[model samples]
Target: MKADFLLIGQGLAGTILSYRLFRAGYTVHLIDDAHPSASSRVAAGLYNPVTGRKMIKTWMADILFAEIEPFYQEMEGFLNQKLLHPQGIFRPFISFEEQNEWLAKSADDQFEGFIKEVFTGPQFPGVNDGMGGLLLKKAGYVDIPVLLQAYRTWAKSQGLMTEAVFSRNQLKRGKDGDWEYQDLTAGGLIFTNGIRAKDQGFFDWLPFAPVKGEILTLRQDFYSSKIINRGVFRIDLGNGLGKVGATYDNRNIDLEPTAAARQEILDKLRQLIPEKVLEILHHQVGVRPATPDRRPILGKHPSEENVYLFGGLGAKGVSLAPYFSRKMVDFLHSGEEPQKEVNINRFFKYI
Candidate 1:
């Protein structure tokens, strides 16, 4: 059986790319084991225009969000679900330097596109230590677990998805520069295995520093319709439940969520709304596929043209993934050029 592409893994990277490929009239065969460590499953899937203490806007937020907005909208409509949220994030500023840096960046012309001067008074009492901060417009959350489930079901129904974990032993390189796996042959193969990318054979040459994240679900008042917090993220998950995340650890791979991380999250949440009633609903941990350079490793394997990869979005996978997936598909389909910053060619010399 001939296929345009054989996509490995059904995480955000694989799902988004395969979905777009199908929409673009390509025949794709997807396979996955649905590992719980998949980042998309545990991700809060929030998109903040500006991230980190540097107070800089996320790399290419306007362009990425613009292209991705309609893509997710179409997915939601197809699934008959609301998968994307346009709710803005109001970050709590804890230090004077934090507020000052935000103000400095807000003054730049680049930031004007995404950030609106946050003039609103504190909606959450005791939030930000009375330090007002910036509001990034048109940024919000994606219900990643919901989207993943919906996409998986759709792909399964279409006979485009398989339940097996794609094995390297099953792959055979053709003499003509292509790949064959069992009864299926493809012009190219893409590995979107999330944190598991480190375990892949040919593509493992790229640097991947994995990070572990732990998130806790907490109960808010059922009447609380607002998504406000200075902590990691605050959202209206409905039925008095809101999810707060994510503690970062570089060394641990234990998927078991810990009480220590839960306590840290709760403490941070309290700084924003001190007197609020809450309950710990659940906690979960997942591994993030972080690269040494913090940019995604995209491109073909050094010795093979058919083997390619799209991993290492770190914590920004929810926001940056859709755009990069589309880029990878285009590059594979039409020989379109990828931005030098993200292409794996930069690391080829070292590898």
Candidate 2:
């Protein structure tokens, strides 16, 4: 078979990149065995404008937020499913000092686009927000697994998705500068295989600090339509169901859900709300592809031609993937480069 591009992994990176390439009139084939522990499959998929305990604006939030909604809205049309949940996020102040800090930010013109309101009164029932909280707009979550499945169905119907394990042994460079992978030949190849990219021969030199995360789904009687985030977050899933958690553990980088992690989430959840946990519906574990710089790595390989990588999104994959995917597509199509921060050349000296 012949195609314009060959992509590895069907995770968020691959799914978004393939969609962009397909829309750009390029025929791309994606290969994935669909690992059950892939981060995209278990991600909470929340995209927030403000992040971290400091509550600073996320990197490139202005530019990234502009592209996120429209991108997912288009994906909703293509997938024929409601995947984008546009409900805003609520972050409660942790202390009186934090509350005063937020009150100061309420008037700051820099936060005008994202801050919906700063409430000093009670925000929700069965809640513990005596310190008040900040309502942030243009922030929400995506149903990643649903979107991934939809992409799979669509890609399979288009004959652009292949379910197979990708091995470097199956890859060869043709004399004409095309990549020959098994029975398929392509003008270029991209690896979007998340942490597995560290194992690839070409990208092994890239700095990857993989971290394990644990999350939980619970059945509760709370009736909030917005996301509540403190140290941990609780996203209202409707129907007496809510999703809570995500504990980061860089030391124990494994895919097993431990009771310790569960207790950690519960501890954090207790600090935010007064609601009692009715039951634990589900527990999930996935490894995030984190980098030391905490920015995504995008661009072609240093030594090889027409070979590229798009990953290291960490916990912010939902926020970063869509925007970077377009950059990757533009680079592939016209050699347009992404910003210096996310461009892979930032770490070229290490490699």
Candidate 3:
């Protein structure tokens, strides 16, 4: 088989990048093992403009937010599925000082687009927002699993995807400067694999700080249109079901869900809302391919010709992927240089 590009992994990074490349009129083939612990399958898929305990604007919020919704909506049209949910996010203030800070920010022109409302008192019932909170626009969660499954089915129908473990040993460089894997040959090879890239030998020198996270799905009666995010995030999945999560553990990097993590999330959920958890529906765990700088890595490989990477999205993949994947596809299709902060050239010194 021949293709313009051969991609590794089919998680969020791979899925979105391949989609963009295909839309750009490129022939692309993917090799994905369908790993159960892939982070995109287990992520809560929340995209918030303002995050963290400080409640400050996320990195490049303007550019990323602008592309997120429209890109997903375009994908929704292609797949004939409802994937993007722009339900908005409500972050309750942790302290009186925080409340005062947002009250002043609400008037700032810089925050005019993102800030939907600044409540001085409790706005929603069952939520623990006595000092009020900041309601944000253009913030919501994507149904990642649904999108991935839909894309996988589409890729298979088009004969663009292979389901098998990718072994670097089987990959060879042909005399024509093309990559040869099994019977497949491609002009370029891109690695969109997640934490697996850390041990992939080629780009292992790059610093990768893998963090393990766990989330839980619970059966509850709490109904809210907006996502409640404070100590933890509570996303109402509807039909008397809501999802709350996630516990971040950098030290313990494994796929197994721990009882302690579940309790931790439950405790944080209690702090955010007074909802009762009638039952625990599911528990999931996945390690994020985070970098020390907390920025995604993309662009061509340092030494190898026609080799590239588009990983290290970390916890913000839902927001970062749509924008950056377009950037990656452009870099691959043309000779465009991605932003220096996210470009793989930033790590050339280490290589």
Candidate 4:
């Protein structure tokens, strides 16, 4: 019943963090309900180096790529599963202006290292695609569900997992300045509870802009066997399967996917190709734990000495989690501070 750390939630953050802690020789007990969500479970797990409308490489793509290149490979040897794949995304130009901008940026030294200089001019096999799009050279996808499930199975076999919802009421702030759960106690606990942390008592002070994302999984036989990279992700998906995602809805009154929303994805997908026959295989939804400034939440709770948290990874969990997790783990064990952007205190007026 006692361990070194009590981890809440088993999403990508928890999964990676738990694995890290375990490797570091710490006993970690993970607790979660394992419901479906688009953040990790439903995410396409695409790692886009440059993002946004301009299609620029993401911040620190080079450093993150170096740190991450072998990180997943090290884990594959341990887990005996292929968790990360080195693939590129073909972002089809959405507009004539976009095409112009892509060409202009391709020569820009700012994007030189992240994206390729030349791409096969817009052409598709029988399927008309985009006008033109930049190739995300270093981008890839992490099979998050496989990673989650593999870690879950591993953690359970090690008796470090529990299938249950973590409630704050189960916590007791003791006079010893350590968190308490039942008769066991740890150095402290971290609230990596994903979107559910918005309701967490004292942690409520953190600003979180929850955005719902939806993805549709399709079974296609004719799609290119290779990872068909395209704008918004039209991958070959391999293994007689493909996943098309995603639409962001911050103003959704309901949490369910709608016909219009499904059509919206279809409409976007059709812009390039002659609308392929896409059947509604399955749909999933999850609230992304976003922030006003689009950074991750990491560090200790302000007033709670030993209590800590690691959440708000947003849509970039696949690309950002491993690097940031190492940073947070370093901070937790060595008192190091998080990077300026990911430092959770930035969003909090006072932490």
lDDT by residue for model 1 (164-283), tens: 977888889887778989888898888888767657677656767888898877776633333454555667688867787788898777688887888888887776656475677778
Candidate number achieving the greatest lDDT relative to the actual structure: 3
Ranking by TM-score: 3, 2, 1, 4
Alpha carbon deviation, residue 312, candidate 1 (Å): 1.3
Provide the lDDT at 75 for model 1. 87
| TM per prediction | 0.91, 0.97, 0.98, 0.91
The lDDT per prediction is 0.78, 0.90, 0.91, 0.74
Clashing pairs in 1: none
Q: Who is ahead in lDDT, 1 or 3?
A: 3
Go through the candidates in order and give the C-alpha RMSD of each one to the true structure: 2.3, 1.1, 1.1, 2.4
Model 2 lDDT, residue 266, Cα = 92
Model 3 accuracy (lDDT, Cα): 0.91
Model 3, range 1-351, lDDT digits (tens) per residue? 999999999999999999999999999999999887688998999999988876788999998999999999999999999999998799887789888888899898778799999888999998999989889998999999999999999999999999999999999999999999999999999899987876568888888888999999998878999999987898999997888988889998888999999999999998888878899999999899999899999988888898889999999999999999988887887789999999888888886
lDDT of 2 by residue, 1-351 (tens): 999999999999999999999899999999999887688999999999999967899999988999898999999998899999988798887677777788899788878889998887777787788777889999999999999999999999988988988889879989999999888999988999988987769898898888899999998778788899988999998888988989988898888899999999999888887778899999999999999989999999998998999999999998998889999888988899988999999988886
Error of 1 at 206 (Å): 1.5
